[model samples]
Target: MGPVAALSALGDRTFGSLRRHRNYRLFFAGSGISFIGTWMQQIAAYWLILELTNSPVAVGALALVQTLPVTLFALVGGSIADRVDLRKMVIACETTMGIQAALLCFLALSGVIAPWQLYVLGLAQGVAVALNAPARHTLVFQIVGRDDLTNAIALSASLGTTARILGPAAGGIVVAAFGPGVAFGLNAVSYAIVIAAILAIRLAPRPQRTAPLPGILGSVGQTFRYAVSTRRVAVTFFTLILVSTFSFNFDVLLPLVARLTLDSGAQTFGLIASVFGAGALTGSLVLATVGRTRMLLVLVGALGFGALQLLLARQDSLPAVCGLLYLIGIFYIIWGSSSLATLQLAAPEHLRGRAASLYFFGFMGGAPLGGLIAGSLTAHGGTRLAFTVAGAMAILIAGVGSIVLLLGRSARARRPRTARESAGV
Candidate 1:
């Protein structure tokens, strides 16, 4: 069959599962709005930082403030999600995000915005996100039953990719038309729409829960132990880290490409980011239609992503980089959505929040470390060298991760050695 015919058939099969569920539709709409605001703030923040410092290192530091909180506090956030009504938790988190954007707008509009001010607000928002991330995923299962869990995950992935395409482009226009502050203010308003959606959702009754009283240190230890104890879970966590460290830093690196390499203005930079978003959008759609829940696809996507990063590193032309970035986005989304679907499905209902916490901890928290490393390395060695290093890191990690997964499978397949143990097994 032709590609279009194949796509049509795939959609016909996959979408039926999604359309049957009303709660999934509501969840999808709310997530889309929230994600759009998220992307808008991200673009505005990066542009503001670049404009203020004109230093790649400073830009990385700004990115750090946005993600470091996740690395530190996500475990506690997961515990909160498990203990609380996750829907209400999302509302509270959204409120915090709205307040953050409002603060950013105030600083920008008042003409009192400093680089340090952005840094502080970014850190504050990051704290809110750390609290929200686990709540967000755990709530997804409530919206769509386990029967459609993989599809819901893919659907959520599509929303992220769609927001990525639209948010940066709109943010650039707003920034160009008025200022960075205007974009931030607009993002704050977008949160109201998400808040309304959350309040409107008719949710299923919650399962029994114990009051989780793990202090920060205890939470961290439990999260770490949980991740270490489960093989599939541990691999999933490590894979997210590998991807974040190598592939996800591309957005943070784009301003460097726009100013130093392409000699493009903010508009061009936004377009470059949008290209990657477009690629991710395509990937998410494909994954949604195909709905692969196996490990094989994840492995392929990881390797494909690493190769795409190397291709991006080799290209200096704006259009070439755009194409490469798109490819990178595509692979990243495919790997991420598939892995998340499997991990979530495998996790026990009781441990879902902790499981998701580990995933976000790897994906979000690892990003700043990657951004810092990429930006600082680029500042000293030049953009090309930085790209080379990033690409190399991705390729290495993908290779290592793939080998580990395969060896793990092989080990699992081996026969029992002890006669008494074998009899019991």
Candidate 2:
């Protein structure tokens, strides 16, 4: 094929999910716009906390508050998602989040914003996220069906990655030129756009469950039992917990790395974040086009991610840090996307919501502890030490996981042949 044709073919393959489904298209466009604002708010909030308290521990504390709800309520949210209309649930959650953003904007603009208020708002936002996440995840399959689910997931992730690229760069400029309040206001507006898009989407009605839904606590317990009943799902969940708890404290680490380690300001931090986003976006696009998911990729990606983190810890120059971050982003997304895809694909349709909730429970539930450790280490030992500890732990986990996976493969290879194979008909 000619170069132009090749490019056209790649686009078609990469965006097949969007073209095939109008609902997913609306979701993609709306989320693409809103995620930028969400990322802007994240940058602004992190910076604001650091400026207000001038302490890394405060940032860690904020992180804890922001994630605590997810840790506590995600399973319940999953239960609700399985029982309710996912579309309506997501709309409600998004609306609540928008209102929360408006409140943040009001506080920032009124000059009455305080660390305590941020904490309160963070808690509120966390509630919305906890409830919203499972429904939102389940909604993807509802929109795109099983055949296109992986492509849709990757594309959706790319939207977030794209937002990360534009949002942080723009957030830096916005925070520097105007203020965080304006950024918060913009985030509120972005939420409205997503809400509208959600309203426009029309999904096929979910088939009714043969059995009535159980009580919330019973439902949560049943989901937990189901998730751990399988070896692969259990391993995936365990690995996720380890990585998320030890290695995924970038929100705390990056700002400190920028301010204290590099002696830079918001602009440099923004640049680094944007570069990381660029690499993640590239990875997402690759995954979207390839449309292949495998367990080996997850394992190898974990190893690569840990090695990159170690390398990133040692870099002193801004350019070098940005480069390492780019590489880190690539491996991180590979590991993350592959792991999530595995879970989604393996899960039964009825159990998918709960499985996804379990995934997030491991993913987000550990953040509070990770934030605390990262913040404390950075405050006491320095950014290098924090990164060193995180990198080392990640390497240890990945190494152990690799050995287990390899051994399993070897044992399977050595198993006796079936009777049909032995007969060689």
lDDT: which candidate is best? 2
* Residues 1-425 of candidate 1: C-alpha lDDT, one tens digit per residue: 99999878777766745677777677778778878877887888898899988889988898888889998888788878877899999999999999999999999999999999999898999999999988998888877778777777777888898898898888777777888998898889889888888888888788775665566677667778877665566666787777787667866788888887788878877888888899999888788777658776676777788777767766779879888888888888887888777667766676678777877888887878888988987788767777777777767776777788788768866955567434421
TM-score for each prediction?
0.92, 0.95
**Over the full model, what C-alpha lDDT does candidate 1 score relative to the true structure?**
0.80
Clash totals in order? 0, 0
Q: Pick the candidate with the highest TM-score.
A: 2
Clashing pairs in 1: none
The global C-alpha lDDT for each of the candidates, from Candidate 1 onward, is 0.80, 0.86
Spell out the clash pairs found in candidate 2: none
